[model samples]
Target: MTILDARESGLANGGPSFSLGNRLLRAVWIPVWRLGAGWTPRQLHPWRRFLLRAFGARMAPGSDVRASAKVWYPANLEMHEGAIIGPGVNVYSMGKITVGRKALVSQGVHLCAGTHDFDTPLFQLEAKPITIGAHAWIAAEAFLGPGARIGEGAVVGARAVAFGELEPWTVYSGNPARAIRQRRRFADDASNS
Candidate 1:
């Protein structure tokens, strides 16, 4: 299979392939992020933006990357068309992170793409991509742990900590990200939703 398909399958299975990708990406990422680490906030954002595009992140026109945010591997992180990744947000993609089209990742959100394997003797690092579905909204200060999945049109409340699958079209809130409600029609539920 092609690399993209392989990555997708690995994301599904969290198997050995994903682990290898995480290690390989981390190997290249540390030095690259270090090189640009000294940049001024303004300069750093644009440079990182360029690197992300160069690495094949399919960003659309007018996507803004503020200098303050940190991205581990530009090539390994994919934000689709019209996605808004706000300032100060860190996408620590040690494996792979795919943010779908028109998704909103608010300011200061932390999405970790790798973790440790407790089953291993050394507690070695294990990489798994975090997938944010289309049109999902991850509020400010939310933390998405490794291998977390946010479904389509879901809303992750502010400061929520999500370490597992979040159902689609629902509103999830609090530290462990419990789903509090399902989303109804936007026009119908506007007042209380």
Candidate 2:
């Protein structure tokens, strides 16, 4: 393979260190979260709501977690004021996950925080924190992979996979999620004018 082809291959799948930690984190977290999962059954929305509240998910008053949404670890997830984790969204946070104020994680979106390594003896897993900045919108069916750091006011378009950092106020989409364009401005001064 040419140098360019090898480089492309590396970009698609990360290196050994990255892979190792992701796998280990997932192995450790899944069972721990699953143990707590029974407190909130698949259909029991109210029960789930209470469980999340018991954990340290700092939801502001009146912020809602829809029934169909699943939080793998309520204690490890933090949602700021006015954040909406909508229906059918799965927050699988083996690593620390934070969603800033007014961020919207729409329906069927998967926020994944862990992956496994192939190089290690045990196939060690690596985990990286996922952060969605304030006012960001993760549209329907979008997936935020490990180490995804979505910037403030950014929008990941429907079905996008944000594998890395996203620029603030930018719109992104596609498999690895390239920046599409700057989001439209809606300044307070413009409204006044």
Tens-digit lDDT string for candidate 1 (1-193): 1133445335435455444664576677656655754344654455666666865565655454555677776766777666777878888876678887778899999999877666655444566778888778999999999889898778999999998799878999998999999975343222211
C-alpha lDDT of all candidate models, in order:
0.72, 0.71
Every model's TM-score: 0.72, 0.71
What TM-score does candidate 2 get on C-alpha atoms? 0.71
Model 2: residues with Cα > 4 Å off, grouped in runs: 1-49, 186-193
Best by lDDT: 1
Candidate 2 Cα deviation (angstroms), residue 61: 2.5
